[model samples]
Target: MNDEDHYCENCDMDLYGISPIYVDYMDLPYCSIDCLAERNTYKKYKTIEEANREAEKNRYRKEEK
Candidate 1:
């Protein structure tokens, strides 16, 4: 397990000591499959092509308040 507090790219939960699930675009690491699914849902996309088409939009949508 990585000692660094690598948080879930989706929910931003601390992902210490847990295995990470990485995506391809930015190689972002997620905490779990559920978190990965939630992220895709948040992007309102089921395919990488669609997500890439509006990557900026998804990025803006997931920005921290």
Candidate 2:
């Protein structure tokens, strides 16, 4: 795969060559992931614990049913 051959589904640029990233359901495509990771590494999402702390800050469940 060559970057010149395939564009990143995100930035529309030929990135990572033409290697199509595998995205699971609810996961991001190559473009979004690349952007989140600053374009030089894989994207990183918050851990469960980290998410809990962020969500627990002076906040009630917004729409949890």
| TM-score of model number 2 | 0.28
Superposition error at 45 for model 1 (Å) = 6.2
Model 1, residue 8: C-alpha shift (Å)? 0.5
lDDT of each: 0.76, 0.48
lDDT by residue (tens digit), candidate 1, 1-64: 3444488877888877677898867668898898887787667876766767787777888895
Leading candidate by TM-score? 1
Candidate 1 lDDT for residue 10: 79
- Compose the digit string of candidate 2's lDDT tens values, residues 1-65: 44353555446665453445635663334544545344333233246455557557636666553
Query: Residue pairs in steric clash, candidate 2?
Result: 10-31
Pairs of residues clashing in candidate 1: none
Residue 4's lDDT within candidate 1 is 47
